[model samples]
Target: MCILVLNRASMTNEQYQSARLSRDSRFDGVFFVAVKTTGIFCRPICPANPPKEQNVEYFTNAHMALEAGYRPCLRCRPESAPNSWAWLGAETSFRRALTLIEQGALNQSSCEELSDRLGISSRYLRQLFKTHLGVSPKKYAQYHQLMFAKQLLHHSMLSISDIGFACGFNSTRRFNDAFKKTLNLTPSQLRRHGLDKEARNVVYLAYRGAYDWQSLLSFYQKRAINGIEKVTDTSYERYVEISGSLAWFKIFADHEGKQTVKIEFEMEDVTKLSTLLTTIRRVFDLDTDITAVESHLNGINHELIVHSGLRLPGVWSTWEAGVRAVLGQQVSVKAAIGQLNLLSESLDYRVSGQLVFPTPGVVSNADLSFLRMPQSRKDTLARLASHLREHCDDSPNNWLALKGIGPWTVNYALMRGQSEPDLFLSSDLIVKKIPKN
Candidate 1:
């Protein structure tokens, strides 16, 4: 069993009681309240009557509650709670392991393989999981898969078998067995009771706190690639390619009151759903704790924090971000996008009403006579592309070894591509002038 480690700064038992009593949406995913009387756990914002404080115990995460033998509350649907990982206070390895697990690292591979990727021994990896999360990495991965499936079961019109396969269960029997054994509820039963019958190919992803939809949308609107990405006043839609499969998705902000963003998606490969959802969450910065982030930023310098709930809007992939950054060097946003349009028009692949960004291989070999830029800049773009193609490495830190890939280009790619949070654009001309003011 996981030991409860409470500190003054962390959410105390009284705080949990208060938040659940008031049904605070901000604390929805921060912790779970497991009611011993009901033998179930629920999100803090559950609409069901709050259990008596004496009968409830707080678990820092849904996994801990589940492991403690508490089934998820069907009414509250704990699976749909916002997935903010920052508050876990875990080190990089544990966090990376969780990311890998979400990407199905343990679905078809062994724990040894996972530890190998992390450059650690399997024993050490297990130790890490036990110490922090109080469960083996395998158990954590399995719980997440089931949670994702539960989310789909409640929100999507996908068939039971399809949801099973989509969530990485090899067969329907296995999925059903695991679902029943762990959640104490059958998938069919949950679907019958909880599913939104009207939903079709739609999944609502949750988030906590204020969201500056206009600010993030405006940022994307300025740089959206035509035919690939489209930004509207109330929604953002894009054609996406993940793990060699193509899909299209649109996200609407109108689900504001529910504390979730509505995602209407169409994809042929159901198995890729988990990865696609993870990508969507990261790209939209859905998993960030805005309250904590804003508080930290305000402490830095109040003036530096311009907008509330402004998230780090991410590009599709690191490769795409690197290409955009190279094109944007020392240029206005308009100029950079113009060059990008020219480049995309020249080399991008088109199907139906959509266009796929040019691959590193395509950009590396392309002649730059069409782009109206200095020859040196064109050469730099080609060099960066060639390096990425040859090495298959997208990390900005690795890109620093290349010429013309300076701090600004690397930082831009890290910020927009990888959604890295701790970046200081001190080299930027505008940022450099901030101290003068």
Candidate 2:
């Protein structure tokens, strides 16, 4: 029943052995080691003695290991390992499907509905997951929810009921049943042996390698919307709307040994926790494979090598990013901030001293003539809003088809809105300044 899901050639047995022997944190989530003798899977950094190579099997993800009948190791707590940023195969559809799943697409929707959103058949989608991940979509989703709940149990002070709802279970009874069935332990039992202190409204998100926090914070400082976002030297704070609830969250790097960013939030609705975490992970590019990205850029240029950890900061919402991109065209960053602040002030949705940006419907129907911008730009904003309101699609090509959005604007929107990593702004004035040897 063991599924050798990951491509074996990606890492040789010797490398995995070395990593496990040395208890290297770098390979913690890249691949899990399942011991045949003990029927348990562990993170690479597990403190237990290294199992004999012949007794070992590797999996690309925790779900695969679980499918092979290996229970998670309690010593290492594989649930807390940083996620593997590497995609298993070269299939773009698989990657997109994985992203959507991480965003809770499967929480309340069928595989068919997810397939429809991905523009593929359910059969093909299931096949793709099996081929690359060695599990069905439903199983994968279930594992993710359980793992998240486990992490919450270990890391947070939240009640078991709150954790269950946050992880997408229907009720406390169901959550308890799931915990008992899956882990052979009740939720309270797990909480009694939790690792961290009972910190309220806090979560630690992990990322591999050194994060260029200054670069990301500076980028956000320039484009920060008034009353919505604020960036300081060591922290970034923002008011976010999730499922109609307004909450403020702050993120700062954990200066301790763990390579993680700590996020703290104030909110009443616990169900939105999963969505909020996903959005924060995307916005910070936490899942980027820094090693691969650095290797790809190595020898390309000296500058690229110097700042290899520079991440493409993403926004909370596509509509917000699109609107900001439109306002930023042909204007200085400072001017764009001023304009956005003005727009926020004029909007009607105010909550907790923060003004929520207008929705596309409101912008499309409103008379934006008072904003002191040129008539052409105003008309373009209206048209963009209307187009966005009419269609839920947020692709770059779709934005490009609009009247005023050109390559730069489209690419900017894609980079920030969609968290696209490979995009480059060739036409950027700063990029143009780089000398071509």
Candidate 3:
């Protein structure tokens, strides 16, 4: 194929230099530069040739990039980037704690469980948040609950009572009291409960920053399990299982104003809605502070661009991600990925219209050979998943006691599923074996 070339338009001096050099993708979600002359902000990895220096300016996010007079690049489509910061964001514990709190870890949970998840005492988790974020963990969690309630308030046409339940409040009276105290407004005042609106099933979700929607969508599209999920032009849908129940949710991105991306969700299983929303955010890596995360990670490995936008790719079910991890224990990434797909389709539950990965309870009793799985590894996956399904709720430290599941699987699941931030799998020998070149 013949190559075609285009002239440079406008970009910052530094950005033009970085683009020329193909610098890291860690800056994918951090900042974009809207060329004063051309009107496009791009991820560091954008393929367009370097623009004229001094014509560009940097922005904190894609939204900010647009607000500062630049449009999004068509090729890079910087919208759907996976969680931008590849670790290295500061105050790791705080972010991890924030993730857990958002997951409803504190809605009906005590400080001890939250603290234990952080591998710290309840006292320490509280002190850490107090010292850095100027709030207690419980108070922080309460703030999150209110913000979540605000999402339902602004998006869903559900009644204030339903909003309270969806946001994890135990009772409508409690929801009312908390709503008034937090927002100085009744939930009714915040809701959009018109008959027409509810008929369309519109519910808008609000978050703090401009997410790279295109970047995120593209990544998930490749890894999306065929029948289990959908990634459309306007929305994303997937499965989540929580507390012995399963549910499906769709996040629709319809409008944008101010600094927020409005996402609307429609859930099929109302009973686990609280947990479902929390998990969806984690699985999609929505609650992350992309700007801060991108900046810190970029500061470390300036050339980690290709892998910088690489997200932790949270899993919907612990048992499922764990088994995938186990099958990959001694294999290359490609081999592991292919084998995982085969295993899922071969033996997982599929009658639900969509193929739902069989839960721990359902698969624990399964015969390994039926999965066409390796004979040696069959019992290991079955038992480990079973142990987690049974003891994931046991008091602190039971994770370490599981027979075939070690730090790799446990930490991976906790970090991916529970959104535990500091749970790093840093010491795996196989991981260390990758050539440092």
Candidate 4:
């Protein structure tokens, strides 16, 4: 029953009817405007004929309209929201469940463990899924598996077995069965490259909408982690490490038609595709409705976005995000970057023109030689990194509680790394102080 109190912009009858009459970019993702007469819900930007004035009703989201029994609009395809990221939106328990599944949680654990982590019961979790996503959590996980397998078949020359293992399959039979169950085509049938094809060695991760190409590039280029991440004409290339293994990624915007961002990946560990893609999405904040976001910020009194929306900064990797947060405890970005460069040169692993992030094992095992600073600060950051290494599971709560890492650090890392939108750094000293009324 959670709902977001979105901004209510004063609109003219023309604008309102235009939005209701034909869903257009102005109202996109702002609200789920339902026509009482037609019994259908659509994005503000639907191109269909406008409904009668008296027949229109606006709900905060499609979820809300759906709860009230309105069916999705067929013409606009409201379900295919480009802004699934919903900038600065609330994070519901269902979203948390989806994130966990993307992290390989369902594959390794169960519904019980998921509920425990979210601080809810298994029954409650199931109820939430039924109410929100309309499918059981397991079914969603199955859909996710099929997606991974499909991507491999289309993008890489990996055998069905390699794709299966990379996507968390126990056996080729299970992978094949699951692929067939969700998509009628067998894994081999739908492959873009058949067996014995030369490896393209490239995979593209689809991000939902258009981006500020120059802005996104400039931000990373300035603070681009030395060897680990590099900016190219088409992408921002980087080294990614998951579960102690290494991978390579090239992230860029697809300028073909409307506009979309893409991640071109090259890796040997195919089983980690699901987790990798999920993490990448979270890190980059894809699935956002760019049309809706620009409107909301533009509507904010005094234009707070003008000051801060200079760039949509995304976390390159969780480990790197955490490390930066730790170093930046009370220091400026310049100061933090300086220290991390030293730390990077001293401890990080270098291969294939990408500097690998210093792993938890290294932080826990070695003394803080490069992290030289106040003894207390040194001990604090090391302890946090060590905790990650020892537990081998970097949960949100545990990640936040580390010393020198307050809500600011945790919020920055999570927003960048987990795509958690509700995390607004209201207390950031540099941010204009709006009284917390």
On lDDT, the leading prediction is 1
| Per-model C-alpha RMSD | 3.2, 3.4, 11.0, 7.1
lDDT of 4 by residue, 1-437 (tens): 11222343444555556555554454555566788987777777677776777888876455556556566664554544443543233247777777778667788778999999888999998887776556677766765565556656766766778888877788999999977655555877766333326435545543333456667676677777777778765567777776656788776666354434555676756667777776666555555555446656767754455543233577855566777777776777778878888777787665445568777777767667666567777876788778877775475556666766677777877766555556777767666455654
Give the count of colliding residue pairs in each prediction: 0, 0, 18, 12
Per-residue alpha-carbon lDDT of model 2 for 1-437, expressed as tens digits?
A: 12222333467777777777787766768889999998889998888888889999888788888778787887888887777765734588888888778768898899999999989999999999888878999888878888888888877778889999888888999889977777767889888877477577777888776678889998999888877788999899888777677777899855464778888887767777877888888898887767656765664754667775787789887888888888887777788778888887786656555677777888898878777788888888898889988886657667777888899888887889888777898987667888986
Q: Residue 193 in candidate 4 has what lDDT? A: 32
TM-score (all chains, Cα) for each model: 0.93, 0.92, 0.61, 0.71
**lDDT scores in order:** 0.85, 0.80, 0.59, 0.65
Predicted candidate 1 versus true structure: per-residue lDDT over 1-437, tens digit per residue: 12222231465677778788888776778788999998999998889888888999988779999899999988888888888654346778888788889988898899999999888999999999998889999999899999999999999999999999988899999999999999988999999999897899999998977899988888999999987889988899988776667788999984947778999998878888888888889999998888777776777888867778888899988888988988888888899999998898888765444687877788888888899988888988989889888876446898888887899989989998888888988888677766675
Q: lDDT tens digits, residues 1-437, model 3?
A: 11111112233455545643463443444445566777766765577775666776765445445434455554554543323332234477777777667677787889998887778888878887766546677766665566556655555566777768767789999988976665555767655332235323344333334455666777566556655677876667876445545556676653554323444445554535656655665676655654444555667876655543334557776556677767766666666666666666766675335567666666677666754446666777777767866765442235556556567766766776555666667766666877888
Clashes of 2: 0
- Identify the runs in model 4 with alpha carbons over 4 angstroms from their true place: 1-91, 116-119, 155-157, 192-199, 208-210, 302-311, 317-319, 330-332, 349-355, 391-403, 424-429, 432-437
- Top candidate when judged by TM-score against the true structure: 1
lDDT-best of 1 and 4: 1
Which 10-residue span in candidate 1 carries the lowest summed lDDT?
1-10
Shift of residue 287 alpha carbon in model 3, Å? 3.6
Please give the lDDT score for candidate 4.
0.65
